[model samples]
Target: GERAASAAARAEAAAATADARARGDAEVLARLKVSEAEAELRGARERLAELAGVEMQRQALATELSGLKAGQEERDRAHAAELARLGETFSGLAGKALEAAQAKLAENAEAVLARHREAAGQNLEANRNSLAELIAPMRETLVKYETRLGEVEQARSEAYGGLKEQLAAVASGQRLVSEEAAKLVSALRSSGKTSGSWGEQQLRNTLEMAGLREGMDFTLQAHQAGEAGGRRPDAIINLPGGRQLIVDSKCSLNDYLAAVEAPGEAERLAALKRHAAAVRGHARGLAEKAYWNEFGAAADFVVMFIPGENFLSAAMEHDLALLAWAFDQRILLAGPINLLALAKTVALVWRQEKLADEAREIGKLGADLHAAIATMADHLGGVGRNLGQAVGSYNEFVGSLERNVLPKARRFTEMGVERGKKAVAALPAVDAAVRPVAARELLAPPADDAAA
Candidate 1:
């Protein structure tokens, strides 16, 4: 009986294994079918696109055909009018009995009719031919488009199958990611590191991770010089203007986080006081260090960097007394924006110094230019004086020539004038010989009357 039972159990186990193997094979076959369907769908979609584009072109060609038909009708109407006019004109001319009248009329009418018929017929035939030629190509295009549409339908079905598979896969992936993310969030909260303490730790770690070494631009964990009198600040930042600032990383996580865990008016008040005291204490240290004196005693106040903007906000919200206390100590409280402003102010100071130096140099240059201008003015004045003397000398020389030489030239000119007068008197005798006897007698009588 025991052997029989053992054999039956073995047979049952073997049957179960066979059933599982068959199920796996069935799933594989289903996946293969889906993949094949997808490929067919893709091919169909491509063919459908081709068909749609070609169908659009066919519609445009049909529109063009309508326009061509209208043009043909207009041409036919014009040709008919021309033919009618030619026939009327020929009939009117046929009444003339000239020798070649009939022949001429018939010939002219036939020529005009032939030209009109040829033009009309050629235009009509060309339009008809064009329309006919378009028909076969358009039909072929339509056939191709229909074939492509059929192909697209098949491709669409295949695409739908693949889309289903893809959607399922994406759903599965999203579900897995959501589950993992939830778990990670749960773990993070469970570790107690997700609280405000974590943020403080992160901020401090970030600063430390930047390789903030001691005795460079900053000093972390630096001790005070006093043996047992003063407080040793947490971190000291050396500013550009010989100013030193003390920053206290007062992780208000203990108070703030506690207030969150246990909400009460008293707890909040206590947390506020603790944070203010922490900042105030750091402020007092900053004032004592006289960090403002580091930059040639230029700055009148020192800065107290809270590092955490949230902490600064909480402090300001809780009690403005913290800021007041800092002010009393000549300590300026700064968050990130205020800190950046302070840095910019420092940069502006340096820029102002550079500008001042440049201004001084410019002043010197202006003085040098003034001296050069004076020298140039002196030389220009000398040149002007020399030019004036040259002008004066030229005027005097021209005056001397006009005064001394002009009268002598005038006397010589008068002598030549007198000789010319005598020559003019001889001109009358020469004219007398060429003149008629009566004219000469009149001229001699006129000379006596002229003298009188």
Candidate 2:
């Protein structure tokens, strides 16, 4: 814009100068001498030359301005094209990034889904295996219960049969009692010695069969004060806690035999009643003695034992209250069956007592073992430190042998002295026999204790 304005101002000035020169040119031309005319022409030529120079300057300015405008237009077009290309490039890059992101997200989703499905399958299998393991024991237990139910049913049938047989035997007692009655009666009547001795012998036999020791578990004919002193009890059975359970043998088999061999039904019933009364009378006599006071540490009851089960059974059948009446008098009635059960219970008590004592001993042993372990651990720590020192010394010795001794030995070999190949190879390793010892040795009684 400044160049155009300067060109316009130069044209206006040239036109004004041309107009004044045209108006004054004829006057100046007519009045001039040759010399003056020549000078005037030179002046006119100079003005013309100045005008041409001005016009050339105006043209140069116009050309430069036009070139600048064209260059500006070309640059604007190029910048727009470059911006459009950049936009297209950016759009392509964004589209590719979005596609890649979507593909990666899809792959991750598939991998996660696959992993979860596999894990679910594994969990289902594990659950099935666990359920199977859990159910196996329960199934076995159910089978065992079912088998036991069958056994119980069988036992019930056998018990009912046994009950029927017992009832039948009771109904037909004469044949069974006649022979046993004769032998026992003849034995008692012939001699009182045979009677007392054999009766006591019979009692002892039953006790022994029930696992009683003679002196350890019972005493023979333990005499008390008064008339009962001369009359001895069969045994004083020892119980736990320093207490005694007294047993007295009473045989009313004669009355029972009489009842069995009675001629008529009424006589048999009367005899049975007498026999039951006699048994109760004996229990009453034993209780009146109050043997618990005599033994000092005895229980408040006595055991009335009948050597014959048949005699006792007959009496019990005649009078159901006989046993109850005896018990009320601080007396316990016992046949062979009851005595055996009592003995077994006593044996069980002894076993439990032994177990309790062993438990106490084990507790003491455990405390001692703990103390021993603590001492052993202290000893082991000392041993470990000593072993570390020994190992360090061994390593030093080996290093000396390798660095110093073997080199000297090599020189000896040059002098024709030889070393065995096996010995040389064996020097680097230790023996393998030092690992373990026998449990017998570990648990063996100490030599000093054994000797003592």
Q: Count the backbone clashes (under 3 Å) in each candidate.
A: 7, 0
Report the lDDT tens digits of candidate 1 across residue range 1-452. 54355445545544554564477654433344444334334434544555566556555655665565566557556755665565577756654453265456557756765775576567557655655564555465456546645554655566577879999999999999999867754554566445334434443454445444346656664555443454444456555556665554433344544444557788777876676666666567567766444334234665565556776887777776878777888877877556655545544565676698899999999999979976876676577667667666666766776678766766877887443443212111111122233434222356767799
Q: Ten consecutive residues with minimal summed lDDT in candidate 2?
A: 28-37
Q: How many steric clashes does model 2 contain? A: 0
Give me the runs in candidate 2 sitting further than 4 Å from their true place. 1-181, 189-193, 223-231, 385-452
Predicted model with the maximum lDDT: 2
- What is candidate 2's local distance difference test score? 0.69
Give candidate 2's error at residue 162 in angstroms: 35
Please report, in order, the local distance difference test score of every candidate based on alpha carbons.
Answer: 0.57, 0.69
TM-scores for every candidate against the unseen true structure = 0.33, 0.44
> Per-residue lDDT of 16-47 in model 2, one digit per residue for the tens?
44564477643332322222323333443444
Best candidate according to TM-score = 2
